[model samples]
Target: MNNSKKANYSIKCTVENCANHCGKEQYCSLDCICVGTHEGNPTMDQCTDCKSFLLK
Candidate 1:
């Protein structure tokens, strides 16, 4: 028998007002996140934002 657990990335986040924020650790509790752009296309990093962000 094998007993193991999958690793979950501890993503450091600064969005304090976001619902995913992990208390005072400044980390995101969500297993994964989604990013989307308002232009319907992405050509630059600034063109995207965390669509998963939910106001606390």
Candidate 2:
């Protein structure tokens, strides 16, 4: 049996809307962290207006 453990990296959400302070960046199953295309893209400012992110 392989019992290797996976390393996890946590990202703290500075966004006031989100209740969770610290969470996994890429490992978050419930929430997804992706890159933005434009300079004003909300996802780029994860701690500001992530709710306005437009996924393409």
Candidate 3:
């Protein structure tokens, strides 16, 4: 039996202010890329802020 637990991986920003659509390895827009860097979360894989984040 497999006892290993599967990791629920998902993209998430650290800015806490941005609302961009972060995917497993992609951002919704370029703005999110900039903001993610400014917010000290430069990790492209883990975006947290984005200027082009649309609130829907």
Candidate 4:
């Protein structure tokens, strides 16, 4: 994982374990992120997920 990369301020992230997360910063390193929901009809924040996340 290259934590030296610059943060994409457009996407704020706090999941330090994600490969796309900006090191020590509250932001994502990717230009964009994919968002998805496990539930067919998502009704809560918990139902939504960061589909772009990859294990670091």
Candidate 5:
């Protein structure tokens, strides 16, 4: 069995209030993140938002 851990790169995030936001670094430390929105058939970037967002 492979015991090696997968590599995860930091994602640049500007939302400071998000729980996953790296302090002052503008990056997310989380290995991965989920994104979603309230409406269906989204057409723009604004239509999509972070589903993993957590209040700071």
Candidate 6:
């Protein structure tokens, strides 16, 4: 993947530690992302997680 490419403005992100994160922009490089929850019955944002996140 071209990690140096411009950010996908539609997918806003702040996790610079993610491999898909645009190096200098606060956005995700991917065209889309997957969101999932760790809890069986998620009721809050904290209970959810970014399933597409990968360690940089």
What overall lDDT goes with each candidate model?
A: 0.70, 0.34, 0.38, 0.91, 0.70, 0.89
Off by over 4 Å in 1: 1-8
Cα RMSD to the true fold for all candidates = 7.8, 9.8, 11.6, 1.1, 7.8, 2.1
**Candidate 5: which pairs clash?**
none
TM for every model, in the order presented, reads 0.67, 0.25, 0.21, 0.91, 0.75, 0.88
Per-residue lDDT of 9 in model 3: 33
Question: Per-residue lDDT of 1-56 in model 3, one digit per residue for the tens?
Answer: 11232222343443323334433323242322334445553556455544455553
lDDT of 1 at 50: 88
Clashing pairs in 2: none
Q: lDDT per residue, candidate 6, 1-56, as tens digits?
A: 44666799999999988989888788998889999999999999999999999998
Q: For residues 1-56, could you state the per-residue lDDT of candidate 2 as single tens digits?
A: 11232222443343333333222332222245543344454553444544433332
Reference-based lDDT, residue 43, model 4: 98
The TM-score leader among the candidates is 4
Q: Evaluate model 1: give its lDDT.
A: 0.70
Q: Is candidate 1 or candidate 6 better by TM-score?
A: 6
lDDT of 4 by residue, 1-56 (tens): 67688999899999989988888888998988889999999999999999999998
Clashing pairs in 6: none
Model 5, 1-56: lDDT tens digits are: 11232323457788777766766566776788898887788888999988878887
How would the candidate models be sorted by TM-score, starting from the highest? 4, 6, 5, 1, 2, 3
TM-score of 3: 0.21
TM-score of model 2 vs. true structure:
0.25
lDDT of 5: 0.70
